[model samples]
Target: MASQADRVAEAHKTLYDQGLAVRTDVTGADHVHRSLQNGSSDFARPMQELATEVGWGSIWTRPGLDRKTRSLLNIAMLCALNRMTELAVHVRGAVNNGASEIEIRETLIQVAGYCGLPAGLEGVRVAERVLDAIREQQSGEKSSTAA
Candidate 1:
């Protein structure tokens, strides 16, 4: 009984839901929830849906690589592109996906050789900031648990 447009909308929604699950699993639930909240505006909703359905749904769900590899690749690519903000976000994602700090450092080192020194330096700075925040958060949890 659904109209053509309705069916397409439902399909897109399905992809979005799948993407949400995959993204949350990779990035942690709280971060995914906050990102969804920030993209709730009408103007931003389209971009959100596209990123969810396309980037997360299509590419992230592929079987060619594991999540950790994908996260590392993103960090490297973001560093090459000089996308520092996205680099920071993906640094967190890389950590969540089990990438070690050393792996991130190595990736940046590779980037410096290919992407130019300035971009690599900025990427290192951004990655360190995210890593510090994550380290601090983990320390807080450990202290609370100990107390």
Candidate 2:
């Protein structure tokens, strides 16, 4: 019989794999994975395990909504919640999931009406940073390819 720790480890691996596939970017996925793990403290381990298994594996792996739609919804929710850090992360995820810059701008505009101006403006700032980073990455990739 597998030990509880072994089972949990296996579950985390499975979920992380699923998350990576949906997220589609190694750096982003690694950031999420590291964040979920919290730290080396034993007390935090279970929370990390549960977050990975349930949040990433169970909810994110659901079939009803595709990754692109989920990314959009996540951006909206993160904005409403005033989670600027997470909003930045999801902005990258949204782009990876096929959201255009225009789509992101429109979403932020919609957020301004319902979630309020402060939250919407903060989201826009984060989106700009994320988009700029993406553009820089693309530029580097192109330059490397050209060489």
| Residue 143 accuracy (lDDT) in model 2 | 100
Candidate 2 stretches greater than 4 Å from native: 1-27, 36-38
Among residues 3 or more apart in sequence or in different chains, the pairs in candidate 2 whose N, CA or C atoms overlap within 3 Å are none
Each prediction's RMSD over C-alphas, in Å, is: 1.5, 3.2
Return the lDDT, model 1, position 89.
Answer: 81
lDDT of 2 by residue, 1-147 (tens): 999999978877898677555543522757765765564478887675565567667788898998778888888999999989879888988888789999998899899999899988989999999999999999999999999
If scored against the real structure, what TM-score would every candidate get?
0.92, 0.80
Candidate 2: 10-residue stretch with minimal lDDT: 20-29
Whose TM-score is greatest here? Answer: 1
lDDT values, one for every candidate: 0.90, 0.81
Report the lDDT of model 2 for residue 141: 100
Question: Candidate 1 residues 37-90, lDDT tens each?
Answer: 899999988888898898898889889899999999999999998888778888
